[model samples]
Target chain A: MSTLAFLGEFGEAIQFIFEGETTREGTQVGGSQFLELTVEHIKVSVVAMVVACALAIPLGLWLGHIRRGSFLAISLSNVGRAVPSLALIAFFVAYLGVGFTNVTLALVLLAIPPILTNAYVGVTQVHRETVDAARGMGMTEARIALRVELPLALPLIFGGIKTSAVNVIATATIAPLAGVTTLGDAIINVSGYGDVGRLAAAISVAALAVMTELTLGAAQRAVTPRGIRLESGRPSRRRTLSTRIGRTASP
Target chain B: MVASAVAALTAPLAQVQLRDRSGGDAGCVADDGLCPGWIADNFDRYVDPLVQHVYLVLASVAIGFAISFALALVAHRHRWMIAPIVQVTGILYTLPSIAVFFLLLPLTGRGSLTAIVALVAYSLLIIFRNITTGLDNVPEEARDAGRGMGLTDRQLLWRVELPLALPEIMAGLRIATTTTVGLATLAFFAGAGGLGGQIFADINFKSNVVVAGGLAVLLAAVLDAAILLAQRAITPWTRARAA
Candidate 1:
């Protein structure tokens, strides 16, 4: 295709997406019609993240507090990385039947490992002296975990959440296959929307993923304690090395 | 309430399938509800797509590693380049794979080229970050010792820096390999065949879904193990030191 013609076609697709027009076959499409699909995408992602956080956070905190089951926690993170989201969705759809619930359940599974691993790592990495001091101060075990470890661990925990949220949003684009209409509907139903629709869908989904990442990344930074943030922000040799390891190792 | 909403949404699609099935072969009545016989009958069909899938992953990861390695080298030298490069790759990483597949379709057409392009783009962040980190973590004393021997920059990098960075580089490769394998499942959308195509083709079939989905999981596990073995082989000195 000529560059000019390609640019024209791209522009037209973007217009079609934002302006919302009927197809040549008199079918209503695009524009506000995509709002419903976007909402569906968010609904599935939110539910999955919520379920993942609920299950992973408390368990991860408890395990990290006890400093046990490091092997299980690490292995589960590895296995989670190995399993493809498409395979999980297909597995669920085959057994559970196609529906929103099935897709959400699969996404929940996808979101869990990162959250769990980060939560565990965060609490376990807290300084022993801090916890000891809390103990010496007559703090109970529960109080120590809550008042001491949890606060210290918040940054890594939030890092895990950010990763999970981004991953869940990206993976949710495939929910249409399970009969849950999301932004993927435009891409999947090629006969209805054509290549133009597919392009528009891709643009929207990419925008959504990037936006979600930016938003959550900011949230993560905001939640980090000021003193720790100052320490981490300054690029000391040890800090840089640990940060790099943490970034690659966790998600 | 959510359960009811799901059921309501699935009803029409189920009815449509039922109507279509009325005219098709009745394969659901098989024993044990698994239809292993169906798999046995059609086992040959999966071979071509599986090969295509593996080919797609290998080509993309190889190309991705080369590009990322070069970029990491440049960033390592300049230092200022790392942040911008990481940000660019992060954006690429965030782009949805299916969208990327279709977006490239207009330019590259529907084939393995488009699929490989998207897969390569997806891998840059992981591989590049790892390589840069590996290079940065090289001991200052080792670099000074190499310098004391009057080695040129090229020799220093090849002898002192890269050897020390091998573990982190291998870690990145392992991650990139497994991730690309997972993402390549969606390449079928671009007409580049894989196990995902097989699963999608017969999503409702127990035997087909099991075989194809199981294969994808198996492929990931096998690739991960292979990388681990390669890392061990290449980093034999580390093992010797530990022993």
Candidate 2:
């Protein structure tokens, strides 16, 4: 198809997104619903991310502080990667009934493993010398973890959050399946949105996901303290070798 | 308890399957329960979709690896290129494949091509980062040894660095494979006939969803195990090392 034909009624599609349209089938779509769905999508993702962070971060930090359950944190991450988002959502919809809570619960499951694993890994990787010095300074365990280890581990912890944030937002596209019509309403109910409107919705979702990733990435950088920022020059071989050894030690 | 839960899950599906016109055993098929007989009899129906799914995963990963490997090699030689390449691929990675399907539809049109392109984009960041990190982590002593033997830069990279990097590279491939399998389930949106298409065709039917989704999950596990085994075979040194 020529560019012209391919973009057939593209202007109308944009209009349909901002100002609702009655399709040939006479179904109302786009317009204000787009804003509603977008808000809902963000709300669900934010809720899931908060819960995931609350549940995973402390556990990860405590476990990492104790330097135990390395196997649990790491393996949970690996198993989490193998589970497909669609199946998880479908299972929840099938068994638990569908709505904001069920979908948010499923997303929290999706979001947890990475944050948990990263938090654990990050704290464990904090320098032994640093931890010892803090202890030597008569710092309590909780104080040391919060003031020293937490700040040092913030970058990696944020790295995990960024990963989960993107995953959760992308997964939110299918929230419509659970009777929560996010932007996926346009994509799923194609007859209602029509082909052009579907394309518009897809573009919007893509934009949303990319924007989330970029924003979180910036936030991650901002939260990282200057002392821990990686220097421009590559580290010497000895430093890298130590990290390599650390990798082998972990599951 | 497990059986009861499965039964509960399947109950909703019975109504969905009731709408389906064709069935060999109307009673079992009608309820859309976990009808093993229906799946067993209709096993042939899954064959084509499974093949297509495999093709989608393999092709996307292969092409992704080829691109990433080449870029990693070039980026290794010019370290400055790494960050920009990563940023671009990272954006690509973050974009969900479902949205990608529709985004590419107007340009690439609907087919395996559209699905593969999105899948390939998603794989690039994972494989590229792994390869670059792997090369970076090759021990200084290994390079010195190669140089002492009068090996050129190319030979040292090929014989010393790349060999040492194999474990990490293969690990990236395994992750990429599993991820691609999960993502490819949505390829049906791009008109690529993967098991995802099968699942989405009658998503409410428990037996249908279970069989199709199970095959996908099974595929990921099998591929992951195969890669792990391959890693062991190729890097016997890793096996010899104490855990």
Candidate 1 residue spans exceeding 4 A from truth? A237-251, B1-32
Two-chain DockQ for each candidate model: 0.34, 0.27
The regions of model 2 sitting more than 4 angstroms off are A4-15, A25-27, A230-251, B1-32
| Backbone clash numbers for all candidates listed | 0, 2
Candidate 2 residue-wise lDDT, A1-251, digit = tens: 46675566456667777887776677667888788888998999999999999999999999999999988999888778877888778767755767899999999999999899989888998899999999999999999999999998887898889889989988899888888888988887765666667777887888888898889889988988776665413565434533443352222
A1-251 per-residue lDDT for model 1 (tens digits): 46666677579779978886787899878888877888999999999999999999999999999999887777788788888888888888878889988998999999998898888888998889989999999999999989888887887888789888888988898888899999889876656776567778888888888899899889887888876777676658443644545353733
Which structure among the candidates has the greatest TM-score?
1
Tell me the lDDT of model 2 at B206. 73
True-vs-predicted CA distance for residue A215, candidate 1, Å: 0.4
**Model 1 agreement with the true structure over B1-243: per-residue lDDT tens digits:** 334324422331221111111212355623213565556666677788778878988899999999999998888789878779988998898888888887775577667899999999999998988888788778899999999999999999998899888888888888888888888888888777787877777676667678888777788788878878998898888899999
Put down candidate 2 lDDT per residue, B1-243, tens digits, no spaces: 334324423332121112342655778677656677777777788889899989999999999999999999999899879879988998899888899988886677667999999999999988888888788888888899999999999999899999999987898898899989999987877778788767766666677878878888899899999989988899998878856
lDDT of 1 at B137: 78
**Could you give the fnat of all candidates in order?**
0.53, 0.36
What lDDT score goes with residue A41 in model 1? 90
Docking class of 1: acceptable
